[model samples]
Target: MSSAKLSRRRVVGAGLGALSSAVAGVSAGCTARSGPPRRLLLATGPEGGPYNAFGAALARAVAASGSRLRIVPVSTAASVDNLRELDAGAVDLALAMADVAEDAALGREPFTRRAAATALARVYVNYTHLLVPADGPVRSLRDLAGRPVAAGAAGSGVQVVAGRVLREAGLGEGPSPARERQLGLAESARALREGAVDALFWSGGVPTPALSTLSREVPLRFLPLDGYVGPLRERYGPVYTAVTLPSGAYGLAEPVGTLGVANYLLARGEVPEAAARELLTVVFDRWSDLLREVTAGARLEPRFAISTGRVPLHPGAVAYYRSVYG
Candidate 1:
């Protein structure tokens, strides 16, 4: 086998071995308690997005695992909305972009006060997508100046990154600033197809379903944003990374460079330790199942999951990881 395939198998095998040990430890130490299952509201992204799909799949997987915790997926505006809902005590768990979560933790722009949110795991990475028509006049970031662009839906992580990217490109607040529209992924794709907007921004898993379908209907192109990663990291810490959208996605003839941000599963500081631990137990045990609904090449390995950067991990997650690594 090729070295790449062999390396992937080694990683997967090691992760699964660690997960098996963790599960065995849990089973041997815990005793059955007779009671109603604990229900948790997981605030996910809008319909058709990776967050929403993964949330639903996770709920099913947890249920199938026979765990006492029952996760209910609640669709929201994604990242920022998920964080706000988590802070408001409206949800027990949420999925958010690391950058937006950091802003909430630090009480940065768009957040009035610091939030008491804790990370369960760094689940996946989202690629920044700057999409335009294959035959449109928007050949570069400069071409977007003074043009209408769907930035992202209000209270979404995409909006936070899109604004920063545009500002860095000098199209945010200049003589010819790009007109911004607050449209969700579905709406933005439709708007682009109908020529209502010149370009749209999205941050989601590779080959986002909406964009993939839109690409089939109307030829689309992804503008490279790799150049902005360095500047963004220099200004906003290390939340952004340079990544590439592999060729063939959206029917691209060649790979397109872009910025990537990690996505995290977060919980309110008040969630019970037992419940938190149980939820993550199932998460790690059923990691492969969760990946089916996430992005291509996604992994739920404990090493990767624990790297939440500045966002503090929940105490329960800390305990769980200790058990896995110990």
Candidate 2:
């Protein structure tokens, strides 16, 4: 095996071991009825975004876990802004893109230095969707040139990936037919309805609520990432993946071919061991119920969530994973 693959396995094993030990310690140290629930504050997004829904589910999970968690809805644009909030200690937890989380910990690109934070869990993959009015002129990515495009909310990972996709499609250059606007999916959908924007690009999960609502009201068209997946992965590394947003994901006319980025729960380097243990239980144990509240929550299984931690897993999360998977 290649060195990278070998290294990945070793790290995973270590994370699994650490997580198991932590969970065991937490369980051994206190009885459920006697221990005081840890109070936690989780940060979410403004509204109508994946972060919002996912954060809500996480809060619910913590509550169900018999823990005291305050879900704080913070206005965020994802990536840089979210990481900044985390770094400044404005919140205890937040949903983040693994790509951005990686950069934040290392303090690279769009960030001045390493963020000193760590990964808690890999929650779900973010699929980028290019939605247009069914009867609108554009059909394919190539057709987006010089057309008005809403590139997701400003500072959002959606916008970042949208810009990358546009660049890959040769629309990022001078005098292109495409004009990229920064707006959330709901706002973009409204703009498309009003003919203010020709298309909307969002990097999120399948069946995104706003997109689903829009598809019901208007004829929606999906533009596939047919030929650009490999190139995107090459440029962005493992952060990009070829994912299909299946038909009916949002009452869509058909499935959308797209690229994806993984979402991760992030924490500061020194988050308490006891807190991490409890947090992990809330995430792994009640995943199904959590998913019912947030679609992404349902996808947070150990086989998937724990397998993709590129950075060092938080010792707390590590402890939880080890108990189950080790």
Candidate 3:
């Protein structure tokens, strides 16, 4: 095997071993149940984003795999909204950003109390996009002050990070604050094109379809956000990391540095162990299909999937990881 594969194997083995201790004495309940395939509701993002595409693909893949779980993807505002829905028993599964998930798990702002959610996997990294018109006067993060900007839909993870970024750049406080507009990807793109918003914030996999389409229609410039990663980590822990949007994406002339946040596949803690294991089995088996829909280059590796930070793993997920490592 290649050195990389060997190293990955070592990491997975060690990580699983460490995680096994946490799940010890934890009951996974019955592994056998008899009935028609159970239908599950999965909360995803807006229509044109990566979360929506990936959720739809995952649901189709689960059906095609002949699993006993029937996943039904539901479109939502994404992240915070998804977690809130899951908490309310409105959804069986949800896709959420690590930062927002951490907030929900810890009972932070936007969440009045701790949430009962656990992770199945760290699905992928969301690259933050601060898009401005090529001919627009906004040259940097500082330039966005006192300007109209689409900061993402109200209940979305994009909004969570956008607010932080804007504040870190000293735009959302005191006088001369940037005018914040709450809009989803499609609406934000249209607003930007119409000169209604000076810039827009989006957090998703590379070459997000709507943004890619918008780029073809208008010359675009992406502002670099690497400078804020350090401060974000300092204030909010290590959930934020520096990432780069490659040059070829959205017709960029060069690579742009940006913030990266992990996206997690979350489940309510009450989900049956058998159902969770079966869901993950199909997901890992058909992960390539999900990637084809979500992004150009992303992996569903077990080692990376198990690193969900403060959000505990679902017992079913822990069982699945143990089985894989063993």
Candidate 4:
């Protein structure tokens, strides 16, 4: 309760202490003194996705800590949408792809304006999945140029990453234009099965439930992305990593070299450092529990978590890390 941000929304979860709060002006901005934050909203990805699952589990862990702070997990389009939520003051914290945060901070293409956000910490690396049917003609990302492809839901981090990968692959303005469909994770899988899309791009943790289910129902294969990693990293900063998607993931037979992007936890830059610190404390303390429930959280290492690229780390997050690591 010592470091919880208060908002008008429903509580995200209870904090460690059963403290209460009294904000001088919640709508204008919270100025609470000596009480648990009434509520907090955490912006996460779509339902049934890794982001949402992990967010829900995090809410549960915070509530179980007995802090009396109520944290509500919000499911959205993910990344870009989460940043928007934070900008609109609809959420207290959010999970975002580092590249998206970098773009948002810079007010680059896609984002019309700069957002008042800063990195709480780096979290995980989402492996980019360029999947096609095992028996289909779309053997690689280049092969799907003329075909209908579900790049990702409109404005989602998935689509953003996909667009970058396509550009780096020299398919940005190729002759055979890809009919990119705006589809969510589940919808993309169903559309692929229904012959609506020849290939689909996804950016998430390994063993994403929807992909696993899609693999079981249909013979699907992921195109290797390692070839573009070097170029992507060179162009898009160090956020892009060349990593091999382990074999047996989503039932693949052997490892496939692919590009991975770092994911981040962010909060409004206006949020008090102490509140940010509390959020970090809860996360670090209960991180193991989150990992046990969803291995996607296993990447929440202190060292990597602090590697927030272009997005500067929050002061509170900095303090928390020093207290623990030092």
Per-residue lDDT tens digits of candidate 1, residues 99-187?
A: 99999999888888998799999988999999999898889987999999999999899999999999999999979999999999989
Candidates 3 and 4 compared: the better one by lDDT is 3
Q: After superposition, how far is residue 228 of candidate 4 from its true place, in Å?
A: 0.7
Which regions in candidate 4 have their CA more than 4 angstroms from the true location?
A: 1-34, 292-297
Return the TM-score for each candidate structure. 0.89, 0.83, 0.89, 0.87
Cα lDDT tens digits for candidate 4, 192-280: 99998898899887767778888899998889999888887777788888888788888888999998888888988777777777777
State which candidate has the highest lDDT.
3
Write the residue-wise lDDT of candidate 3 on 1-326 in tens digits.
Answer: 11122243533342233224322211121123345667677778776578877877786666666566766666678899888888887778999999999999999987999988999999899999999999989899999889999999989999999999999989988788899999998899999999999999999888888899999998999999999999999999999999999999999889999999999999999999988999999889988888887777898999999999999999999999999875
For each candidate in the order shown, give its overall lDDT on alpha carbons. 0.84, 0.69, 0.85, 0.76
Q: lDDT, candidate 1, residue 260?
A: 98
Clashes of each: 0, 17, 0, 20
Clash count in backbone of candidate 2? 17
Q: Which is the winner by lDDT between candidate 1 and candidate 4?
A: 1
Q: What is the TM-score (0 to 1) of candidate 3?
A: 0.89
- In candidate 1, which residue pairs get closer than 3 Å at backbone N, Cα or C atoms, i.e. clash? none
Model 2 spans with C-alpha error above 4 angstroms: 1-37, 68-73, 296-298
Could you give the candidate ranking by lDDT, starting with the highest? 3, 1, 4, 2
